[model samples]
Target: MQKSRLLMKFQSSGHTTAVLRAMSYASPSSKLKDMTSGIEFYDKITYIEEHFEEEKDVLVQKL
Candidate 1:
């Protein structure tokens, strides 16, 4: 049991670090405007990886 808990703690910490790194490298949102119509468009932004989400879900369940 002790080993299992320790493994989980390590995995959680690693996933957290990965999430932070991914967020730091993700591109900031950018806006674009049409020259003729003067309409603005915004790009969809991604802050984290999908694998992180899955890892988090698993960690939460284990806890």
Candidate 2:
């Protein structure tokens, strides 16, 4: 168990690092847009996104 736990500690491989870097470099909204491109899902995605934007605005206003 100790040996496996030690192995698991270094969980990320080069591929994982590459993927994280790519995702970090892109705008998160663009990533969401890629997944929500279908017509049926677009409206639902936008509605949820609007709520997120509203919450962000409120937090920013408080600050």
Candidate 3:
């Protein structure tokens, strides 16, 4: 779940796509498949925004 938030933030900020590529190489245990499922994107974002309330600077730094 945490990793998914990181990936989404990376994507939202227009990183060089390296993040997505790296995710592809991640082990199945990372739950990359669940993260990549399109249906979960918005929900995950909402969850992150509501729960983590992550600051933009922190998010960018994590990416």
TM-score of each: 0.23, 0.24, 0.31
Best by TM-score: 3
Off by over 4 Å in 1: 1-12, 27-63
Q: Candidate 2, clashing residue pairs? A: none
Using lDDT as the yardstick, the better of models 2 and 3 is 3
lDDT value, residue 10 of candidate 3: 57
> How do the candidates rank by lDDT, highest first?
3, 2, 1
Candidate 3 global Cα RMSD: 10.5
- lDDT string for model 2 (1-63, tens) is 433332343253545434543564486764554344322244444454568766777657766
Runs in model 2 with CA error above 4 Å? Answer: 1-12, 27-63
For candidate 3, lDDT tens digit of each residue in 6-42? 5676577644344444554565633465355432445
**Model 1 lDDT per residue over 18-44, tens place:** 454355445332111111111111011
Q: Candidate 1, clashing residue pairs?
A: none
Scored by lDDT, model 2 comes in at: 0.46
Q: Whole-model lDDT for model 1 versus the true structure? A: 0.36
Using lDDT as the measure, the top candidate is: 3
lDDT score for residue 8 of model 1: 59
Ranking by TM-score: 3, 2, 1
Error of 1 at 49 (Å): 32
